[model samples]
Target: MQTAAALRHAQRILVITGAGLSADSGLPTYRGVGGLYNGTTVDGLPIEMALSGPMLRRDPALCWKYIAELGKACLGAQPNAAHYAIAQLQRIKPDCWVLTQNVDGYHRAAGSPPERLIEIHGQLSPLFCQSCGAVDPQLSEHLQRPLPPLCKKCQGILRPPVVLFQEMLPERAMETLHEEMAKGFDAVLTIGTTASFPYIHEPVLRARVAGGFTAEINPQRTDHSAAMDVFLGCRALEVMELLISHI
Candidate 1:
């Protein structure tokens, strides 16, 4: 049973999620049991190199392959019980906020109100023209070739609308998050992520600084996991579902 005493004692709640949350829905990653990479997974030459921004720019083909694989993985993915539970948790508290690192759009698809949720990394819903900066509407279509879409204006290649490895978190999203943390959360739950990146890590720390109940749920111990008051090593969605069922 979830001891939601922490939640019960607070009126403000913030939920943060990372890739681990999506992994539970069968999205592939190189970590944990039965993950995609056997030993060392790389994007083009290797998983690490492939994900590097320099590599992405140098070899668009490699980036395309990596992104397309992700697209394929997302094709059959649907919101799991955990995603729904997060939504339910939002409704349980009137002042609830969800900050997600995932670009999968799962949180939005799961019925999380746009006003209450922020995707710091951008959305997986659309591909954008890098040259002209135009974003295409989200639609599922088969890629006949292994290339990113192009800008209709300049014919320059398009890229996933998501923030890339070299990119910084959107300034607007970051500012809003800082302000939200300043407002004082009742409890803060970081699900399936290690706050490795500066932008993603600070808000969770902010919650802790404010004496907000801090927690995390992931399959492995992470840098941020040790700092949490309640750290549960399990699939993010599974833990979320359990928490939602009780509260």
Candidate 2:
């Protein structure tokens, strides 16, 4: 495949991913069928509001209800072929780095090195106490506890470190992304995302401006579709499975 040809020739590649990357593992996207944003909660608030930082602070119980539900859904899900493919690619190409919008932590679970993987959205694996800054990596255990689980260190409310609607992306992740972009890349590969965030598309745009290859794999057309050198219209897992064979 031409996409594979591009990837094989590239030394330093930037792989950007989004929610669709984990859909095959039974995780839902943010704005699609059965997605978290598709419906309202028991209190009639939109999922966005229910999951926002303001709501978490205003009504921890109400917020935790949805958070616990989401955690439950993600608890048993495993990394799928697409995730493994990315990890394998990174293994073969040591210069590959992944910038993912997923908070599920499947990339790390799939053996993608933490040093090369940037979770643009904070992950669900680490729950932090907003009051004391204590962290609990056992998110599943806390999900099974009372609503708005408390911190073991200071008995304060605990929350997943995920970036909420009202919050900005993690500063460190952003800084690292800028650093990576400044260093330039040989190619840009985007998978499963609509490229709604400007930062998500920035690297690809930059690489394209620098005369580097740019490719996208998505089931549906996205804002970046017009600019991609290769647009594989298929599920991420299916596309990655094929791409891995060529790599």
Top candidate when judged by TM-score against the true structure: 2
For candidate 2, what is the TM-score? 0.95
TM-score to true structure, per model = 0.85, 0.95
Error of 2 at 232 (Å): 0.5
Q: Summarize candidate 2's per-residue lDDT along 1-247 as a digit string, tens digits.
A: 8889888999999999998888889976543322333386557677778788899899998888877766776777999999999999999899999999988889999999999999998887688899999878888887777788988889899888888768899999999999989999999999988857878778988999999999989999998999999888988988797798898
Screening candidate 1 with a backbone cut-off below 3 angstroms (N, C-alpha, C), the clashing residue pairs are 41-47, 42-46, 42-47, 43-46, 43-47
Off by over 4 Å in 1: 1-3, 30-44
Clashing pairs in 2: none
Question: Candidate 2: lDDT of 188?
Answer: 92
Question: lDDT winner among the candidates?
Answer: 2
**CA RMSD, predictions in order:** 3.0, 1.8
Question: At residue 194, what lDDT does model 2 achieve?
Answer: 80
Off by over 4 Å in 2: 31-39
